[model samples]
Target: LKFVCFNNDGIDEHMVWLIGLKNIFARQLPNMPKEYIVRLVMDRTHKSVMIVRHNHVVGGITYRPYLSQKFGEIAFCAITADEQVKGYGTRLMNHLKQHARDVDGLTHFLTYADNNAVGYFIKQGFTKEIYLDKDRWQGYIKDYDGGILMECKMDPKLPYTD
Candidate 1:
């Protein structure tokens, strides 16, 4: 797996992931800009972006740094449609969490997930903090679906060893 910054040449890869994200929001949102995908990809810091693949990108995730927070936000995470639910997401998340713990001074990682993803996040030990009952995400979220904000703590609680 290689961590790559967004290059204009990566449009195709970004589009593939963006479509998946938009599809998740389609039920409540409308008219997603294809350019937004490119913008988000390009705007991310090089070190914070990662693509996992042996040869070509099979999956990818982005970490956007946020203020008043130590851990960056897990912005976009996608595994190819054909590769979903096959443990790629879990592997990607584990890598992301470790990167935050070992490299970045991250104590917590956060994201807004949809109905289908809540269970996945929970299985990863992420707990729900609050549910935005309505479309609090406005242009970003779909009106028909509620948005769940979840967080995973990164501070490892280990037994004290004298």
Candidate 2:
């Protein structure tokens, strides 16, 4: 699968891609309202890193980077149920982290993982012991009702894709 990242550079130009990404995320998150997924995917501040194969979007992570804050918040992360366990999730996340670091100048990632996702985030190097100063991300991100906050500090030396 090829990794593709999209932002709201020119909404009109990338509408088709954004739509497909939205649909894939929606399917993966059947419990989440489709409208909510649409809002996040289309938000101007958010960027989506997707895994596409045979010209079809298979998985993606939608995140919003707070550049001045030196971090990015993961809004949505998922792989098609059929595509899980094949390592696409890892590749997708590595691409997102690299893109955030190189293009957005972000050095950390924060995510609110519900019970079901906590283990996955842990495997991706996220820790509940948030090292980021509370003052930086406290009021910036929306609090999720039943989600546990996790943080991942980007390592500058490692090539994540490897």
Candidate 3:
């Protein structure tokens, strides 16, 4: 699998890749509201890293930095259902960790892990955290009951690798 940093200038290409993976979120993350997903896709504040196989987009991750560039949140990440459990997610996440560290100079990464994805995030070095900044979420996160807030502190000495 190959990964590409999304080019902001290529809106059409970004939409094509995003549309291709729309079903994965719709089906896998049913609890997540559709409006939120659409907003994430339409918003330019976020940056994305896409996974490609044979020149076709297979998966991707979208994220954005907080007011403080040292911190950021992963808005969405998904691989085709057929491709799950094959270490693709790990590779994507590792790429994200590296990008966050090298390009953004970020020290921490945060995200809301759905029920089914909690364990996966844990395995990827994220730990549960109490991030109570409702303003930061734009009221998108009401209660932490449905999902878990996870954070990964990047260690400069350790390399993120699959």
**RMSD vs true structure, all candidates:** 7.3, 1.5, 3.3
Measured by lDDT, the strongest candidate is 2
Instruction: Report the lDDT tens digits of candidate 1 across residue range 28-139.
Output: 2233344654455556342333454664556666556443345556655666677677876776677677666656656676676666778988987788863332233334
Each model's TM-score, in the order given? 0.64, 0.93, 0.81
TM-score, candidate 3, is: 0.81
In model 3, what are the clashing residue pairs, if there are any? none
Q: Which segments of candidate 1 are over 4 A away from where they belong?
A: 1-32, 45-51, 130-146, 157-162
- In candidate 3, position 22 carries an lDDT of 53
Off by over 4 Å in 2: 11-13
Please give, for residues 1-162, the per-residue lDDT of candidate 3 as tens digits.
678765344578667776655555656667778878766755677777788887677787878766454777787788887888998898998888888888878777778788789998999889886443545454443345566788788788577764
Sort the predicted structures by lDDT, highest score first.
2, 3, 1
Clash totals for all candidate models: 3, 0, 0
As for lDDT, the candidate ahead, 2 or 3, is 2
The lDDT for every candidate, in the order shown, is 0.55, 0.87, 0.74
Runs with alpha carbons beyond 4 Å of true place in candidate 3: 67-69, 129-145
Cand. 1 TM to true fold? 0.64
